[model samples]
Target: MTPEDRFPGPELPETGPRARLALDPLSYGYESGDHGGPQQPWAGPGYGGQGHGSQGHSGQGHGGQGHGGPGGAAEGAVHSGESSTVRGWFEAGGGATASGFDPDAPGRPPFEPTDPPTLDLGAPVSAAPPAGAPDPLPEPADTAPVGPLYAVGDVHGYLGELRAALYEQGLVDADGHWSAARSRLWFLGDFTDRGPDGIGVIDLVMQLAAEAAAAGGYCRALMGNHELLLLGAHRYADEPVQSSAGTASFLAAWRLNGGQQNDMDRLEPHHIRWLSRLPAVALEDGHLLLHSDTTAYLEYGASIDEVNDTVHELLASDDADGWWDCFRRFTRRFAFRGEAGPAAAGELLEAYGGHRVVHGHSPIPYLTGEAPGEDGRPPLRITGPHVYADELAVAMDGGVTMDGRLLVARLPLE
Candidate 1:
C-alpha cells in the first residue's frame, strides 16, 4: 500500500490524533499537502474557521485562524499559518542526513549538550523586543490584529524557561492558563532531549494546544529531530541501521546527544502518535517556519505541502530507513548561512512560500560562530534570535542547554 494508505480515510473521526481543523485548507491560500483522497476535518471545539496553508505545499492545515485580534483586523491579527509545512533539526551527515548552514562545518550539534542547566534569569541575556521577546507584548499600538503570530525556539526540555518566557508574553496567566485568547503560538520543534523536563514540556504544549484552540487561538508544534530520535529509540531500541558509522541506532544517537532517562520513561503512546503526525514545513503570514535552517528540506519535496506530506507519510509508516532518512534531512543545519546563505533561504522561500524563514534547532551562538570567553568558556552568550544569512533566516535556539535563554518571539519582527 502507498503512504496515503497509512492514514485513516476521511470516514475517520477528526477527534483522533492530530486531526485537521475544520474549514477548507485551501481557502487560506497556498497548499496543505493532502494525500490523494477525501480529507477529514478536525472537530476542534470552538475551532470552526478558515485554515491557512504554506506557500506551495499540500498537507495538514497549519492552524485555523479565527476572529482577528481586538478588532481581528485593525492590523496584526495574524496566526503563524507559517508552519503548515514543518520539519525538524539534527545531524545524521555526509549530505544524506545533514544540511549545513555553513556547508563546510559540521552540521549537527557541535557538542553533546551540557547537562540541563538553569537560566540565570538575573543576567541581562534577554532577546530584544519586536523580534525576540522577554518583555510582555506591549498593548497593541492599535487594536490587536488577529492573535499576533508568535514562534518559540527549541524547548529542549527546558520547561521552566518555557513557562517563564510564555508568562512574560502574557500568553499564560500566573496560573499558566491560556490567556492569549486570539494570539497564535507556534513551537518550532525539539520538545525533548538534552534537558530535564522533556515530558513536562510535551504535556504543557499539549495542554496549551487544547486550551488555545478552545479560546479561539491556536497552539501548534512542528516535529524536531529529537522527536525522531525518541521515536526511533522507542521503536528500534538498539536495532542497528546502515550507517557510515558502524552499529549506530536511534537509541545510541539519542543517548549520545542528551536523551534523559526520565523523559524516555515518561513517554506515552499518545505522544508518539502526535509526534508522528507533525508536518515538516509551513508558511504563515509570509514567514517560512521551520525547525532547522537547512536546505535539506528541498530533498523532501519542491513545495512546502509536498515536504510536509512526504514527512507525514514516512512517519506514519514502519519504514525504519525512511524514518531515519527523514531524521537526517531535518538534522542538517547551517544551509541558510554564509555567502550562499541568502540563496539557501531564497530557495526555501521560493518553493515553500514565505518572505522570511523562522526556525529553531541550531543554537544562535552556533550561527554567530563566536568562540567561548577569552578565558575559555562555552561559546558566547546568546541574545535570543540571531537574524543573519542577510536577514533571510532567523535562528531561535537560545542555547538553553548551555544555560542561555529560551526565546519566544513575535513575528514580522518590527
Candidate 2:
C-alpha cells in the first residue's frame, strides 16, 4: 500500500508532537583520488583545507600524508621538499591516481590534470524551517462590536459621586446597583487613595464586575499609578528608594499624592494583591485604555502583552526603586497637549493596536485649565467628554475628586 493508503480511514490527532530530519547527499567535492564517505560524497577542491568546502584530513595524523600505504611515503617526500604542498591521492573511476608534486626539487613535475576538481563553495546552506505556527492571539469574539464600553474616570473613593455618575449614565438604578444590562463597564483605575470611602468604591466596582459578567457583559479595570503607589507603600513602606531628585519613601510619596490615611488604614492583603495584578492598559473595542499618557510605557515592553507583563512583574518585585520609577511614569500626563502629542499618541496606538487612546491620568478640566472654584469664580461647564490630540485621545478624568463631575459616557461609535 502507498504511504497515504497506510493511513486511510483513520483520524489524525490535531495537536501532537512530530520529529523530522533532513539529508543532504551531495554537499562536498574532492580531487581525483580523494573520496568521502557515502553520507558526504562530494569532495571538491579545498574539501579538506582551510577555506570553503574543506573538511581537514582526520586520523591520517601527519598533516597531508595518509599513514597506511606506499602512497604515504611519496606524500611525505613531496611535503619535505616544499613549504606548501597538496599531497593526496586523486582517484578516478578506474583506479587510484597520484597528483600534485614538489615543483622546485622535482626533476620533472608530476602529471597535473588541466582541470582539477573545483569546489563549489557557493552552495547554499540549509535554512531552518519556518517557525512553527505561532500560538494564536486571543481574538475578539465576533466582528460585531461587543457593547458600549464605558469607563469611569478616577473615583478617588468618592462613592457618592461615583454612584451619581453611574446613575446619570443609566448604568445604575435608584438602589445604587448596576442596571445597564449587558453593557461593559470599566473603572479607569484610581479606586482609592484620595477621598473617603476608597474601599467602598472598590467594593462597588468588584460587585459590579460580578453582576455585569453574570448578565452577559463584563467589567474590568486597569492599574493606575495610585494603585501601584498604594501597593508599593503598603509592601515596602519601610524601604527607602534613591531617586535623582532625592531619597524618597513610597509611603511618603503616597501620602503626598493624596493617599488618605483612612484608606491606607483599611487596606488589606487581598486588596493589595488585586491592585498589583491590575494591568497598566486594557485594549477594548478598538480603544487603548490606560491611566497615564506618557511614552514611558515603551520602556516597559515593545508589545501590549510585553508591557503589561513587564509592568506587573516590576510591581511584584521587591525593588523599591523600580516600583517608584513605574509609579512616577504612570503619573505623568498631558503627553497629547504639545507639538509631539500626535506622535506620542501615534506611538501608543501603534504599539497597542488601537484606533484611539482613552486615559484618566489627567482630568479634562486640568487639560482645559478650567478647574472649578478657581480664581474665586464658578467652574466652567463641560458639556461632553474632552477629545484631545486631534481627536486621537480622550481624557475622562473629570476631576470628580475635586468636586468636579465624574464622566460616564458610551464610547462614540464614530
Candidate 3:
C-alpha cells in the first residue's frame, strides 16, 4: 500500500487514545545516515501524512546567528541584518526598548494591541446649546486603514500549497516575497515533519520575517508540538523516556510521527536556536493564539510570558529528562474538544485574557464530524475555520497532513 493508504477512514465519533496517538508517518523524514538502524519503511500501521521525495535546505542561517535580541530575550526585537523597511516597523512598534509589557502584570493592563482606540470620558461638554442652535458636530478626521491580520494553519511541508494560500491573500507577491504592507501574519507552527518540504517551509518563514517587516508588516510564529519533537530527536536522539504508552525514545517517536530524514540532515544550530526562542502562547488582537488544543499549557505557567520564558529556559538547558517532560506535555491534544471543550476554553480565556481562543492542531473535519468524501479522500475545499466551544475557540489546522485543507483565516471570527 502507498503512504496515502495509511490515512484512516472518517474519524470516529469519539476520539480515543489510539486516535490521539495516531502516528502520521508521512509527517516525518529521516536521513538515511542519521538513523543507524534499518529504515522502517511505511509498510506498517502509523500516522498518515508521509512524503516520498527528499527535501533539502539551501539557505544559510539568519542574522544574530539566531540570537538577535538584547540580553537573552529575543522576543519583540528585530534582527540587525534585516532591511531598513522592517527595522523602521520594529522601531515604530516600540521594539527598540523593552517596555516590559506583561499580559499578567500586577496593577497593569493585559496586552491587547488590537483593542479599539479609547475615547476620553472626562472631557467637559460645552454648556448646553440654546434650544434652536445645536453646535454642528465636528467632521470626523480621516485615518489610514490598518492592514488586515492573517493567520495560517499547519503547513506540514506543503510549500506549494502554503505559497498559493499566501498569494491568494495577497500577503506575498507572485514571486512569494512579502507584499502586504502594514498587515500582520501569524503562523501557528509545525513547519516541518510530515510532508515533503519541512526545511523549505522554515526557510521561507525566516526569509519572510525580514521581507514582511520591510513592508511595514510583521510575520510571527508559535511553537508547535512537532517542533518540540524535532528538537528532542536532534538533542536526545535515542534516549529513553517515560511515556504513558510505556518507554519510548525521542528519535523513535520522531520517525513514527513522519519526521523527515532530509529535514533532519539540514537542521542547523541557527534553526535550533530560532525554534528555541518561539513563544508557546501569545495573545493577539484579543485572540489567544496557541498551537495545541490541549490545556497542558497551564502546566507551564499562569501568564503567557511566564510560559514562554519557562519553555525557552528549558530548551537552553542540557537536562534530557527536562526536555522529555516538555515534549510529553506538548504532545497532548483535545483539551478543548468534545462536550467539555467549552469550559476548558473558557477557563483558559479567563486566565489568559481573551474573548476567544484561536488555535491550529485539531482539524475542522474531525471537529465538525465531516467524513472523508468518496474513495476516502477529504473534501476538495474547506470554506473557513471551525468555530466551536460556543464560539469560545476557533480551530484552523484543517488537517493539511490528513488530505484536508490548509486554512488561512482572518481574525476576530464572526
Report the C-alpha lDDT of model 2 over 1-414, residue by residue, as the tens digit. 100000000111111111000000011111112112111121122111111112111122123432112211212221121101111111112111112111121121121222212111121122122122312222322343255677777777778878887877777666666566567777788887545677788777776665655545566898887788778767766356765434555654554344444566566776777777888888887888888766667889888889999988887677788887777666655566544566778888998789898888665654554443213556545555677666778777776644456677677523
Better of 1 and 2 by TM-score: 1
- On a 0 to 1 TM-score scale, where does candidate 1 land against the true structure? 0.65
lDDT tens digits by residue: candidate 1, 1-414: 111001100111111112111111111111121111122222111111111111100111112322211111112222222111112222232011211011121112232222222122232222212222222223322433367788898887778889999988778867666677778889999887656678899988887777766555678898887788788877765455654323345654554344555676677888888888887787889999999777778888988888888888877778876776677556656566555667778888998888899988866654554423224555466645777666777777876754467888777663
- Report how far residue 164 has shifted in candidate 3, in Å: 0.5
TM-score against native, each model:
0.65, 0.63, 0.66
Alpha-carbon RMSD, each predicted model: 19.4, 33.5, 19.0
Question: Hey, what RMSD does candidate 3 come out at?
Answer: 19.0
Kindly provide the TM-score of model 2 when superposed on the true structure, using C-alpha atoms. 0.63
Q: Candidate 3: which stretches are off by over 4 Å?
A: 1-146, 373-381
TM-score of 3: 0.66
Error of 1 at 342 (Å): 0.5
1-414 per-residue lDDT for model 3 (tens digits): 211112111111111011122223222221121112212222211122111111101111112211111221222222232112221211222111112111121121111122122111122111111122212222222343266777888887778889987877777767777766667789998888756778889988887776655555667899998898788777766555554334556655554455655677677887888888999998988999998776778889999999999999998988777776777666555556555667888888987888989888766654454434224543435566777666788877876755566777777656
